[model samples]
Target: MLLDTYGRIATDLRVSLTDRCNLRCTYCMPEEGLQWLGKPDLLTDDEIVRMVRIAVTLLGVKDVRFTGGEPLLRPGVVGIVERCAALEPRPRMSLTTNGIGLARTAAALRDAGLNRVNVSLDTLRPDVFQTLTRRKRHDDVIRGLEAARDAGLTPVKVNTVLMRGINDDEAPELLQWALDHGYELRFIEQMPLDAQHGWQRDDMVTADEILTSLGGRFTLTPEPDAARGHAPAERWLVDGGPARVGVIASVTRPFCRACDRTRLTADGQIRNCLFAREESDLRGPLRDGAGDEEMAELWKKAMWGKKAGSGLDDPVAFQQPERPMSAIGG
Candidate 1:
């Protein structure tokens, strides 16, 4: 198991398929986008599948989430998912995408053994969406969400980041839209992951403010702490019934102590934490003909040195990761 000295075993693996994205979300990257990985730097389908197989069959990863600069942009994503599905003791599979091309691929991805999806959709208004993502493909995201639901991606999750003045006012409306559309909604506090390194704590929409804004329109009952487990999102029963909502307060209420996730960059570097300043290279050894056991031991050693927390509370000590959310595969 990928157990750290802090005793947090990482069973959830987030693999970045590429450092490429179609949309330029203001919080992720600049409008012109950042320098992308060279083709040779990215892991091929076989390499990705092999790593995932080792994580599941060898390191005991129970869940595998394919992330990216935008995973839908990966050419062999479907085939990759299909191959990973064939592994012994198959792990649960999902994707975190920007929802641009998902409209056309949802059904195919479902058939490829992808269990579900977590799409990024900040607002229901096209104008606001365009402003936030700096893309006019708002309708495409809507279509993608509808397609995922139609394709039987149960409990389709919508990840919304509430920026202070940008789309913070849409919190209630976003939740209402998700509820009406039968999608699970999660509000994530904006962290210091932007490429511009322009994140300001005062400008962020905290979890408390989110609940307060939504309280004006709907009632939210807190879900039990035990029910949260290692998940980052602290959930709530929306209106005291079947429908529910979640808030991932990474800035204010960090969940580092229970983090079970380990990230693999598009170039195959192991990131024990999202805000980690260091990485362990797996691609180099793999291309050098390292065996599976050797690579797995390297991964184990990386996790064993993970820090206890992200250190966000100490502004002076908490330096923004050199790599932005795009390169880091949020």
Candidate 2:
């Protein structure tokens, strides 16, 4: 396994296929969106396949998740997934999506070898959805969730970013709704990764606040630690429900100690941490015909230099990454 200096193993790789998104989520991107990278700057489908192959075969990566500005927006998404599925000792394949286009693509994605999905949904109310995403197709995301479920992506996880006054009070409703539909819910504390620099530490609804809201509605008990170390969310069981709810308290509670993941940007830079100030250029090396051994060393070297944790909890030294959430491939 690839080990960092702090003795953490690197086994999960999140690869971003593109930096283009259809929705203009207020928390994720600017209303106008970004000037996307041109095609040539992106890693070709073949390049992505080769890198993942090296990570799995040489570097001992076991989980491969595709994230993006919106992964489903990429034209070659299915092909990219197919390549990962073909890996020897096939890694668990997954994706994190906004679910706007998932209604049409979910089945194809599953058929192409995606094992599961985590869909980002802030609100079930149409008006609230429109307010958060600045989009009119709230029902489309719902339909996409249905499609993914029907395609055998069971226990479909919902990632909801919570704000102090916006949707924070909906914890019970969201939890009950998720349990009712057999969906697992995870509430993420709003972080300072927004494109518009609108994130205020005071505005974030913390994990404690979410649990407090749920506590008033139902009996919740903390789930045990995951067998695989350092799961991002803290899990809990609803007293009478079959499905579970979780919270990724990234801002208030950091889990950098057990992070076994690294990230690959759509344009081919490798990031050891989501909030990393520096990136290792893999595109140049790959294009120059670097062998797997060489490329793997680059990845290993990068991981070796990783910081202890995302130092967001430190008020005096904390600095938000230069790239916004969309560019960073959450």
Candidate 3:
């Protein structure tokens, strides 16, 4: 197994299929639209599959998550999912989507071997939704979530980014909605990924505030395993029903101490830290006819170099990377 010096096993891989997205979220991309990675710069389906195989076989990876500016925008997303599902041990595969095009592809993705889906829906209010996403398809996203449920994507997760002055007030309402609809609602604290937009710590809403607002009506049971990987979410289940709620406290409560995730860009560069500028390019070597064993060694070296924590709290030490969240594949 690929073990890092910090004793973190490299088991989960988050792949960004493309940097292009339909919606220009206020917190993600610029209002004027942003430049996207070139076609040749992004890894092809075959290359992505090759990398996944290496990760699974050599690193003991048991889970694979597809993400992007919007992974659904990828031409052969279903095909990729199908390939991942066909692996020997068949890792638990999932996808993170904006839910804009989900209504059309939910069934195809489910049939292609997707275990679950997480939809980004910041606000329930139409105006707020448009304001947050810079798109007027709030209803479309809602329908997409329903379609996912109908397609048998159990425990459909709704990811809500809680920006203090933006959508923090709607936390209780969102949790109640998720509980009613049987969707796992997750509230994520905003981070400083988009350096161009000028992220501020004061704008964040802590997890404590969110739990306190629940009024102690439901008992919160923590799921320790949820903190095992790069999953920033701290999971908990409500008293009744199968409904669960999670909080991704990146800002107020960092999970860097137990982070077991490593990301691969669409172009095949392995990133140890999302906020770090360093990356090991795997696409070039793979294309240059590097053998599987050689690639495995390269991966081991990269994994062994992982730091103890992201150190996002250190102002002098923490210098934000150039890539935005869209390019980095949240």
Which numbered prediction scores highest in TM-score against the true structure? 1
Cα lDDT tens digits for candidate 1, 62-87:
99999999999999999999999999
Tens-place lDDT per residue, model 3, 92-123, is 99899989898999999999999899999999
Say which candidate scores most in lDDT: 1
Model 2 Cα lDDT, one tens digit per residue, 120-181: 99988898888888889899889999999999976689999876666777889988898888
Sorting all predicted structures by TM-score, with the top scorer first, yields: 1, 2, 3
For each candidate, give its TM-score against the true structure.
Answer: 0.99, 0.97, 0.94
lDDT of each: 0.92, 0.88, 0.84
Query: Between 1 and 3, whose TM-score is larger?
Result: 1
Distance (Å) between predicted and true CA of 237, model 2? 1.0
Q: How do all the candidates rank in terms of lDDT, highest first?
A: 1, 2, 3
Model 2 lDDT-worst window of ten: 221-230
